[model samples]
Target chain A: EPEVTQTPSHQVTQMGQEVILRCVPISNHLYFYWYRQILGQKVEFLVSFYNNEISEKSEIFDDQFSVERPDGSNFTLKIRSTKLEDSAMYFCANPEGVGYGYTFGSGTRLTVV
Target chain B: AQTVTQSQPEMSVQEAETVTLSCTYDTSESNYYLFWYKQPPSRQMILVIRQEAYKQQNATENRFSVNFQKAAKSFSLKISDSQLGDTAMYFCAFMRPSGTYKYIFGTGTRLKVLA
Candidate 1:
């Protein structure tokens, strides 16, 4: 089965440093999303992208965060300056089809010191 | 706005037994989708099953089945003949049929299938 691929399985960075998490969604998928789960907390939606632009974003997706479909297959999420609270497991996902289901990547664990 | 709630934080079932995880949501829109996702210790999100709000028939996949009550706004997952591998955190999610396709997930129910 085709799966979403996310780079940097685990990352550790200083609180003020920048980090870029990358994902390659399923080739035929039209929608892409970023979700984060703080330890012991529910997974929260950060942003959704389509047609080369952000379709919607949650309150957690603030100025410090940004997402890009830099190219045909690569979708990336960048954090300008990480905060200690930013530590979480970030997952990239895309729907199998319109409301059919969603396939999620293994997730990039971001740890900010 | 949509909110999914999984009231049970943790549950355990003996191997080969049946277990059900409960989920409820609040949504005014009649058209939407409900889902149950599994997250093991590896922390990978896996789609288990899905139900379209308009469909009254529940969805089932092998040993995984769901009891979807549209009137009560409830969607519950039932795992039959549970195996040790079934141990994981189960999340119930909600999504609007149109617009951004953003998903709202519940806090999750941690299920342990004991050997």
Candidate 2:
């Protein structure tokens, strides 16, 4: 099975630093998404991207956050200025298609100190 | 807005036995998709099973199956012949066939398979 790959399984950074998370979605997938799960909490949607543009984003996806397909195969999320509250496991996903379910990456654990 | 609820915070079952996890959702959309995902100690989210609202027949895959009641807004997962590998945090999720492609997930149910 094709898998979504996320780099930097774990990352620790200063509270005010900038961080970039990378993901390589399934080769044939058209839609990509970013979600975060705080410790012991529900997974929350952050944003969705397709056709090299952001399709939609949740309120949690604010000015501090931005996503880019940068290339045909790589999707990246950049947090301009991280806050302590930014500590969480961020997952990149590819639904593959409209009716298919999501295939999530192993996740990048961002630890903002 | 759609919300998925997994009422059971935690559950335990003996190895080789069977167990069921309950899930319910609130959605006004007539057509949508439901899914059950498992997150093991590795914290990797894995897709366990999925069901389409338009299909009255339940969906099953290997040892995992789902009881989907569209009218009641209920979707439950049944694990038969459970194994230690089945111990994980199970989450129920909802998504509509729209442009956003965002998935709304439940708080999660932690299941323990004991020997």
Candidate 3:
């Protein structure tokens, strides 16, 4: 099974500061997704990326959030201005295409102070 | 839009015993997939089992299996001979077969396997 690696297993940042969460996808996989789980809550879809562009996104993915595959290897989620409520565990996932399961990163736990 | 519902917030079973977690989803699409993902304390999403809507046979993986009732819109996971390592949060998810294939996850059921 292919693995997706997430950086900074844990991060603590001040409210209103910009934060970038990075995910390293498998070299051959083209579709990727970002999801966040607030403490004690269900995991929510943030956005999906395909072929170096945004394919779709949920209402939770506001203008404050942006995703890109800079350099075509590392996929990143950037929060323009983090709020206290933005603290959660963010996971990056890669689907093995149709009829297959998805591989998810261990997750990055973001803590806002 | 598709929605997954995990009615149980928590459950527990003695080691070597059996336990079942409940899940229900709402979707109009005829072709889709349902999945059960295990997230241990480590918080890594591990695929436990998956069921295709078109398949009548229940999906099973070792000690884990699902009773998928398509007409009832219900999918439940049954764990046999549960072990301490089985303690974790179980999430039910729904996904369409095409397009972005984004996952809609339920709130999750925290299971505790006792000694």
Candidate 4:
């Protein structure tokens, strides 16, 4: 079982501030995903990246949200201007492939003040 | 568009007893997959069980099992001889076999196992 590590286990940022959540990608996996879960709510898919491009994204992924494999090793999700509603647990996931389930990072708890 | 529904917001079961969690989904596609993920207090998503849409037989993992009714579009999880460690938020999810393979998750059922 490979691991997807997320940095800054917990982050606190002021509203309107820019925030970037990082995920260390698995060496051989090409598909990566970002999901968010508000406190006591269901987890929702944000976006999926494949071969260095956005493959699919949900409506929740507005202009404010962007994902990139900036250095080919680290996958990052950037929120241009955070809102109080953006406060949630952001998780990075790597799917082993078809039929195999995903491996999710412990998560980054983003707190917007 | 695919949606997973977990009608039970919370449930409790006594240790060593059996309990079942219900899930229903709406999808037009015939080929897909269903999953049950357990999120503990730590908030790590753990895969509890999976069932392929085409398979008629139920899928099970140790104490966890799924009764997948493809015709009814219903997937239910049954835990036997439940343990205290089973306390967590259980989310039922749906995934397409192709495309981006992104997951559509239900709100979740918070289960508590009492001693």
Top lDDT hit: 4
TM-score of chain A of each: 0.96, 0.95, 0.96, 0.97
RMSD of each: 0.9, 1.1, 0.8, 0.7
The segments of candidate 1 whose C-alpha lies over 4 angstroms from its true place after superposition are none
* Model 2 agreement with the true structure over B4-115: per-residue lDDT tens digits: 9999999999999999999999999999999999999999998899889999999999999999999999999999999999999999999998868689999999999999
Interface RMSD of each: 0.6, 0.9, 0.9, 0.6
Q: What is the lDDT of residue B113 in candidate 2?
A: 100
Q: What TM-score does each of the candidates earn?
A: 0.98, 0.97, 0.98, 0.98
* Model 3 lDDT tens row, B49-73: 9999999999999999999999999
Residue A35 lDDT in candidate 3: 96
lDDT of each: 0.94, 0.92, 0.93, 0.95
lDDT of 4: 0.95
Checking candidate 1 for backbone clashes, the offending pairs are none
lDDT per residue as tens, model 2, A1-113: 88999998999999899999999988866678999999878999999877678889999999999988777789899999999999999999998567678889999999998
Runs of candidate 2 with Cα error greater than 4 angstroms are none
Write one digit per residue (lDDT tens) for candidate 1, span A50-75.
Answer: 87778889999999999877787798
lDDT of 2 at A13: 96
lDDT of 2 at A89: 97
The lDDT ranking, best first, is: 4, 1, 3, 2
Weakest 10 consecutive residues, lDDT, candidate 1 chain A?
Answer: A67-76
User: DockQ of all candidates, in order?
Assistant: 0.91, 0.84, 0.82, 0.85
Q: Report how far residue B65 has shifted in candidate 2, in Å.
A: 0.9
